[model samples]
Target: MSVEQVSIEDLGRELGERIAETPEYERFEEARAAVQRDEEVQSRIDEFEQLRAEFMQARQSGQATNEGLQRVQEAQDELHAMPVMSEYLDAQDELEDTLEAVNEAISEPLAVDFGGEAGGCCQD
Candidate 1:
């Protein structure tokens, strides 16, 4: 079929489906699942999130201290030091790299960057 025969949304959906079948995506999914199943990692993530939230709240209320921010950072560092979390982060990076390559391929043929310009303004 001609390119004009298919809607851009349909093409985008097909691309998404194909991406989901890729090895990088599969690895990322598996790693993420493993992270979810690890109780220790989950507990650490929860603690870190709680610490971050409290720090944010304190900052908003003008009561945040340097020590509070340092604690949040330390908690984050400790969380990332876990083997499961490391694997998940690596998988995530690989998947992001794959997506970036795909974005470049899609953007190369167009006058404007497909991923950047296709949003039609109001992008954050």
Candidate 2:
């Protein structure tokens, strides 16, 4: 009897590409750009810290805007969509952290702060 053995390396390469081509992967790629800079993800831990500080300051100063909040939410969404592969997990973590910081930065601020504030009530 002959036995067939599959090497882990071969399996990994095959699976990696297959998984990377999924719609989810495409979404991940789109969302990831928001968090990655220079091919390196920002430190999530530091992002959280900065976020907290900024949030507190913004709220205290009453400088919050809707756009700011939207930016934070976008980061949060990106974090949720980040890739889960072992090789990419670290980068994901960085993105998550940066998102947290972004959230803090936008908290207490209206989304309009980022731009394009809705002007006047619509009467079309």
Residues 1-124, candidate 1: write the lDDT tens digits: 5665888999999999999999999999999999999999999999999999999999999999999999999999999999999999999999999998899998888845765668677765
RMSD of each predicted structure: 2.9, 18.0
Q: 47 in model 2: Cα distance from truth in Å?
A: 6.5
How far out, in Å, is residue 88 in model 2? 15
**What's model 1's TM-score?**
0.86
lDDT of 2 by residue, 4-106 (tens): 8899789767756775665556555755555555233455534545665676678789997776666566655554454432325555555556545544555
Global Cα lDDT for candidate 1: 0.94
* Winning candidate number (lDDT): 1
Candidate 1 Cα errors over 4 Å, as ranges: 1-4, 121-124
Error of 1 at 76 (Å): 0.5
